[model samples]
Target: MVTPFQVHVHLRRHLMKELPETDDAVAQWCRDQFVVKDGLLDKHALEDTFSDKELQEIRRPVKSLLVVTSWAILVSLGALKFLHWSALLSSWKGIALSAIGLAVVTVLMQILIRFSQSERSTPAKVAPAKPKNGGEPSETRQNKEQ
Candidate 1:
């Protein structure tokens, strides 16, 4: 079985020699190189499919979100500095804000991690139909009926 990591390494090595000149060329190259299942390049069909420009565009919004989030956190911290530590901890609103901030940061980190990974290309495997009534499979039964 060819792993997705192996496929990524292969694509990167080949692409380094000759990058596709256009989007259509890139799509053609991908199709010729490996089977694309449901528009995804990997066998597992996770979120590991994106062009270079698409990745750049995704990163742009994520970067802006991170910057804004960071500033908000800094400002929150500055505001909290004026209050006593006990008061800050006892405040439910402050706790909720901190939780929300942590969640947003966690999601952004996951997105960054996912996009930083390489692409994969492999054929998806189709499982055989299970036998019905402890007899022939559905396909065989249908063929017999026909």
Candidate 2:
């Protein structure tokens, strides 16, 4: 949901000039340690390396604006399509309500996006094995006993 402007501003503010190569040795180092090395290394063990402060700072307003603007555009256009502009002007309450409805919808969609991504990823595949005790021994164990 990050907009181009927010991304550009963040990079410029942080003085980030270029992206790191995926296979770079430094990338591996950062995986176990902090990529930024802003004295936050080794804080999170194997978990995502994102900082909540940075995340909230960046994500909050960026996400909000994206929602708000998209809402504004979509609602305005949809309203214009569904109802006459003159009619909307006559009923100020209806126009205001539609705007509110669009804002609520935008927020709801953002929440759902966050939750869906946070859901646990599917586990890796594993081969099936014989039951432990179904009145029969595993083939390997039976062979070893013989």
Candidate 3:
């Protein structure tokens, strides 16, 4: 059996060879696709499977949430149909109230984040110094006059 260290070395070379050439555009492309694998013996192991297709594959579940949530609501209401109206009122009341609370909290969070980001740096502090006029202060003037 191949040792893990040897396997890691093999993977690392494979990753480096597969990386785009060191031109700016290609490097940026690689940066988006490739992450530095720190744990392996050859730490910079880079493998394939980075692309728009990969991202879409990853995002499938998130994109399906709208469809899933709709179906969930339909199923729940179907089960609720045999129940009394009071059951419906009690079951969904908290969900509706929580949704409203979430909206209000989200708006407040956005306002707080915007204000925090917009805060400007305070003006730099100036060192205190004796005020000077057209002539140097007398204590210093005699030294200059000499």
**What overall lDDT goes with each candidate model?**
0.67, 0.63, 0.60
Global Cα lDDT for candidate 2: 0.63
In the range 76-104, model 3's lDDT, one tens digit per residue, is 89656734443534657856865686699
Q: What TM-score does prediction 3 earn?
A: 0.23
lDDT of 1 by residue, 41-122 (tens): 5533465554443332224667888899999999889767845554645779977876787799999999999999998978
- Tell me the tens digit of each residue's lDDT in model 2 across 69-114: 9999998898687767456545779779777887999999999999
Cα lDDT for residue 132, candidate 3: 61
Judge candidate 1 at residue 35 and give its lDDT: 60
Error of 3 at 71 (Å): 20
Model 3, runs deviating above 4 Å: 1-95, 111-118, 129-136, 139-146
When sorted by lDDT, best at the front, the candidate numbers are 1, 2, 3
* Global CA lDDT computed for model 3: 0.60
Q: Of models 1 and 3, which has the larger TM-score? A: 1
Instruction: Tell me the spans in candidate 1 whose CA falls farther than 4 Å from its real position.
Output: 1-88, 122-146
- Worst 10-residue lDDT window, candidate 2: 6-15
lDDT for model 1: 0.67
